[model samples]
Target: MKLTKREKLFERIENHLRITARQLVKFDTEEETLQYLIDSSRSELKCDFVGIVLKEGNYLISKVWSGSCVSISESFPIKIENCSPTFLNKSITFDKVDKDTICEFSKLLLEENILTWFTVPLKDDTNTYGFCIIGFMNYVPLLDEMNRVFEEFGKDVAVAISLSRRKEVQKNKMMGVEWISQNLTLDTEMDQIVGKLVERAGKGTNAQFACIYLYNERENCFILQTPAYGEKTRLNKILIEKNYVLKEYFPYLETPGGPQLTVPLVIDLKTIGVLHVENKGSLVFTKEDEEILELLSNHVAAMLENARLYNNEKDHKQRLHHLLDYQQALVKETVEKDTFDGIVFTLSRLFSKTVMIFDRFMRPISYELFDVAEDELHTLMELATFEVYQKKNRDLWFSVDYDRNMGVWSVNGGSDLLGYLAIDITGEEIDDFFKLSIDLARNIASIQFIKQKIVLDAKEQVKDSFITKLLVEKIEDEESIIQYANLFNWNLFHQHRVAVLSIDLLEEGTKDNILEHQAKKSLLWDQIKTRVLFYDQDILFANKEGEFILIIPIEKEKEKPKVYWAKLYEEIKKWLALEGDKSKILIGISGKTEVINDYFIMYQQAVQALNVVSHRFSNVGFAMFEELGSYTLLHHLKDSSIATLFIQKHLEPLLKYSEGKSMDLFHTLRVYLNNNGSIKETSDELYIHRSSLLYRLEKIESLLEVSLNFAEHRFDLMMAYKLYDLYYSNTALT
Candidate 1:
């Protein structure tokens, strides 16, 4: 243009800026754009070196530089606050290299043979990005116009840097949106989503490191996704804390390397995971970057939560379908086949666990074992008792051992407990699915029990009617008796004893309400029946008001009748003790008989023996008619007036003579007869001196007119005393 030097310089700066602008459009990154500006400035501004240091956070980091002083400029990193005033906002020119007169920025420039140089603040109207320093090796005059032109060029550089950054930020934002739309979805696998999420977050935000930590509810810890690129120690610290606020940079997260930002993937106000990015290129994380990640995190949380719900729903549907199939199988097998074995097999197949059904007495009635050893099954069955099963409520699980847990539900038929439905769980945590399935199975089992109970109850009515006629001598026809007995698979022609069992509450036990009392009685009777049946299947039984009458056939064995009864008595007692509560169980047995007609008399004898134990023995465990010995006569004559008159005639006089006396004459007579009339033995038994016992005996003989020295008189007195002891153990002397 043939203008003055000032105009020419200004014109050259404009041309260079135009060229840089065109080049800026070609480059994409901030580094590329800044490098072009530095290169153009060094070539057109006639400088030995040019470098641009931008303010990033609180420091002025060298972004790009060109020319001969590259090593020196690259080494002299600058903090904005630590820079000398000469290298700050205003342009400063130096005539020559003078280390003593200048700041470190100029001193470093002079060391590279730069005698004349100036710095211009690369600033827009709003703020300063940083300063651009231009150094010349040879001397050059700092013309005001050239300085002004360079300053304008510096402003152009700041605008270009700002535009490039805006482009990068916009591009990253779009990339994040596209990635979220494409990858984070219900269709995506969680592993794939999380892995790509961390990598994409780091790349999109211009951060060197990124991580995604998913929370595990079961373990109550965070699980780091695979292939994570980040400071795991710092990420782990945040995870351990678990107390970070959403979408915020913790003050303590700031480090010498860079600042860190964490945004939790929250849903329903609960943090399911977190999106963490650190070292976002040389700058602190901006609110926009955080917002972008926050949006992405929120979407991820929603997707994760939705996917979880979807999967749970799918699982629930499958579980319901399985439970329905199990129920149908149970109904079909238990109702159509009329067996509990099907129930056990079905449940075992459904749950892949061991299944056992126990009758009301805790005896295993039906079982299907799966992957269980014989010894372990025995141990498990042993653990399954009314006592232990009752300790936990129905349909709930309790640990039976370290590796096994058990759940039991009572199969109830109306007011009676039919059985228990039990399942053995090994090495698995119980969930609602199992509980629901077991509950359904128990219901089906209970229904089947009720049906069986209905049929059995009809049979019981007929048996009870037949037994009543037999016991009351109503069925005198032997053919009718044999026919009825044979119907139940019983051989009544054999010699059998009638054992009348009476169960009552212990005197010391708390009195229960009527229903509770009956329930306990029913439970106790079930236990007794199970034990007795195990002993002998031919045992026939019928329930009366408060007792159970059994027709127990006497087997022809070497063991005596008393010994057999004793063993049976002990077995019943063991069953009672298994309840872990106390009760009175009294059994009265009649003498063995072969005649069917004599069954009535034998039943009477059993009743009499039971009465003796109830009244004379305070309801002791058991008594037998044959074991009663002399008491059998009393049992027969117990209701006779002659028996009463005999006891009165023998002991009434002694009772009258011993009135108000410290030494009882009637007691002395009893002791004298019990000791075989031996004076010393009688004295020892009475715990008295021989003379004192003789005096009482003489008084008794005088009152009753009995000779103590004669055997005939002693025999009469012994009979009288035996009668007295039998009828008058308590106060009433019948």
Candidate 2:
């Protein structure tokens, strides 16, 4: 098409707009660039009423008006859709509009008598937001040269908007990168980092208020740590769930009472927590600001993660060192009968806490204090046990109410609890010093447990050795044995019974100084004599090589011989197990012999029975001479063949059936006899149904060809079973 003068003029204006866009890219701020575009366009496109009416929806608002026109608000609405086809397409147009189209533009436009208009759409690479309309009050002919200039001007205007947007984006991206770099350089201490972030971000964005809500993994919640306001700031530690709702469009948005922008602190696409910047004013946050904050949050999250790891590692190292030192101290000292006070003193010095050591029974053994009073200390100890030690959970460091005034950080070592260490951190720094100290306390508690075990084992060894030596050396004199027992601080003056047990030790060296010292210091044997004698007198009291002899005295006349023997045997076994050794113990009782002179014969008998039972049975436990009957004398005689013949003839069926796994026939026989042949009682005792017990009895009757229902037969069979057991059991020992 042949171009008119007016078309030529529009073309020149379009080219000028593009040049202006390129120039606008150099400016940093949005307002400065926008103003530059308006001034440049008006001066270049010299004409009356050369006002740049920046599009405001369906109405045009004059941003820069050149000639005389009534002052119109910058935000006046204009209906550009109906005004020009070119404006709707976000293109440039020189349209001759009639009164009908003018009226359609807007009611305000009609009232202002806007007849003709030229419009250029202001757009970037994206959709055009609005158009730049130039209104002419009177109609003018479209001269060919003018048409060219106007067309060129429209193109320039499009180029200007595109370049301006590009520059703004580039500037924002650069600033974002800088902000992230600075954020990462912040320290790992969360409060310090949060403080720095809030200060820098608030000033940079000109925000009224700012806060950094850090994620507390333990609580599984976000805590607002750094508030721009003072300590009384209502925003600190606000939970995300209590305050904000998460959304895909914008995770942060303005709420009912405030303008809030929350960006998730994300690392590796995982959202750790949210960072919130809020203002009470009506200032709307821009998209660019949100992006920048998001970028900053990313750096903050990564730094926080690193800081947490660093703190954990440092604490672990400190704990390891404390444990090593504690273990060394325990190994060097004798801790057999350490009081709770001694334990507390040791541990408190280790971790710098007021520590209390409790046994599994929840009794305080030792405690150490700084400024706390005795009653307060006792109360704190009880509180610690109730709060942390009794609980099944293994929370290492927690808070405990201290006299209702302050809360102390307590570290617990869980049930069968090794007690707790409470530090008065009322005035300490909230950093590595506090965390490391708590960790060290836990380590010391663990070491204390190990030390206690070691001390107990040592005491047991000394007692075992003392009894074994007295028995093997034939020191059967009660006075000599009593004197030897005195070496372990066991009193023999009280009414007592001597028990001898032989246990094969695991190691070559039987002498343990810790055990010996514990034996000398223990009050367990204070009122009663406990002498542990060994088998080989020449063997240098090695815990590994020989049998142990135990002498236990009962101070009470009411104590039964069998009952005391069983209790003593169990106690020894438990002590042995704690030593972590596999030494089978064969225990023998001398009955409840009270006379000091009789202890010699009783000791020989007990030792003899121990040897007999250990040699006869694969698993030997406590054996009493009084219960052995004739076998006690028979065991000393060594008549193996005669004893075997008697067992094979009378108890053959019971033995064979028991060996063949037929209802544990031996055990059934023993229980049946023990219940005095009462079928109902035996069944109840064995937890077996009555019918099953009857069947077993009937089977035994048939096998033995004896009617156990008769009193005479029952008596004969019971005696025979007892005799057979005695003969074989004793003969095996010989």
Candidate 3:
């Protein structure tokens, strides 16, 4: 049975090709097929090295390589004038004696001590797809008859590629027909279907990483999910890369880490998602794997289509079932109950369990708790982390295990999450029917919630109007103001200070009406509500003209407005600083209320304080009108005549001396005042040495004909500087 070396080599090559081809389509993706092609070729066929080079425009790009000491070019442009090897045109062999483009690449084999190499074109009758490389460590002679086997190998590759191109449409249609016959209904969950496909794609393909991205048509984005074990998938995870589809990236599958294979999930001609596979080893996905994965992805899409249809049908049935009940409940709740508490009580009795309603900000607005423990309620609250309750994260539903002697069920709204609606049933287990009922309850709750919001919104609009009218119309009658506030459910007639919170980067963050601006406002309002509610319930969260108009209660009769505002400002500022990407906020507060009817006067003072702070302390986040003192008085001045004369008398000499000078006297004076006239701070601000700033200050004091040490003189100088600022600004405008 002993055969010649040539006979043995022929038999080995033939056996390897048959074995690889038989298992080729067994792979889930092209990446698995590629890894197998190279690794199996080296091990089973006893080849020294193997690689795949794919055609890209006028270049032969080495996609992947395997084996000891082997190497390949990353890119080799085809230059017919330079006699570049066109492996795509036809496969060929190489030796040391060959004088061709193969020799340029043959040097790589030579460097690896591989003296013999052969390339087989992976092509069909019409198109040359690419080529595969097999190199030998020692020079080996090949029989002329062996070319037939190589040709057959190329045919197998061609067949695989053809299958890949067709499976997305034709094969999927057949599977769709088979799926219904086999009782695989459309009610199957899409994620479950995708997970099965992805797991198989990675494991079957022998890929290091795999990812599937389902297109969300509504969002115009793709929801990406990857094999949990795939490190590459997690490391490069994106929330939703916009405007990308699978077909666009079909031509090239190589990534920064390795060669990847992408195939589309198509059902009924609509592409739903993309399946990607990556082999950890140095190899590109093979044509066979591509074909196999295409089939796999198409099957997944068919299942997804069924799931979608099932959901639509199921939703239609539910709507039809509940139409009457929903209508009756809506009318009764709106007409008879007309309040959140009444609606909550009705829902609680209907469900035979306590239900709690959280507002959009996660605050408990209404609830009917019958037997829930306080600690248990607290635990549930803690469970609503950013990823659980926040609309931005939007985790809609979760249920605790019923067998654990405790069960907590929760669901968001039907159309959109108005708030958290949760049920407390300690001993009850949930089935499909119970889940359906809960969904129905949530839909009913959404309707009622919307109704309540409409009523509240009307009240808010009236309140906004009332606040503005009080400020502008000079509504000084305390009894009239109280009655007006009561009508809108606001108690703003009490001793409450007016504060305005302005977002500094409103235009910057929310340009073109980006949703981030609205989300930011919601988050900020929640923070404000939490802080304000901690002190007392006599506070209002409202806004007018991009500013948060807060009517905060004055807690103590003896507490100074400056001290109280300062403390509150510090606490809020600390929280604001922790907001990673949020814009800076500015707060302006007026002096505490003397009487309820002075709401207009206090609001005016708050606005005036904000203007003065913007000019005098631009870097500060919060300022009170009482603390502004002289700055506040300057803002109150209507004409610049007296202020101009005062400024000219105090610093007229210094102004004259510094006219047309490069060192700006106005900037120097402002910096000195801002720094509390400290020599070091002034020097640092002006980027000057201490001696230079000291010299300027002494000269200024001499020119002003007053000692700067006296508080009265310092006050006069500061006031004069503020007046000069006003006069200069007015003169510039004219």
TM-score: which candidate is best?
A: 1
Model 3, poorest ten-residue lDDT window?
A: 402-411
Ranking by lDDT: 1, 3, 2
Cα-based TM-score, every candidate:
0.70, 0.49, 0.44
1-734: candidate 1 lDDT, tens digit per residue: 46887777767777886677667656667888878777877777777888777676666667777787776666645555556645556566675334465665665665677677777777777667788877777887777756666677667666777777777767766777787887777766666776788877777567788887767676556666665765554544334445544334344131223477777788999888777788765566655567667767866888877776776788899889988987888888866866788878888898888888887767787889887776776676666773445664445455667767877777777666778877877765667877677778778888877777677677777877778878875556778878988889887778888888878766433354777777778767867776777677778877654557888877832358777777887888877786575777777789877777778878877876776666545435788887877778666673667766888888878776678988788877776776778899988878999888877877777788878898888777777766665555435664
Q: How far is candidate 3 from the true structure (C-alpha RMSD, Å)?
A: 23.8
Ranking by TM-score: 1, 2, 3
User: In model 2, which range of ten residues has the least summed lDDT?
Assistant: 527-536
**Model 3 / residue 480 / CA error / Å:** 5.8
Candidate 3 TM-score, true structure as reference: 0.44
Regarding TM-score, does 2 or 3 come out ahead? Answer: 2
**Candidate 3 clashes between residue pairs 3 or more apart in a chain or in different chains:** 30-289, 186-306
**Every candidate's lDDT:** 0.72, 0.56, 0.64
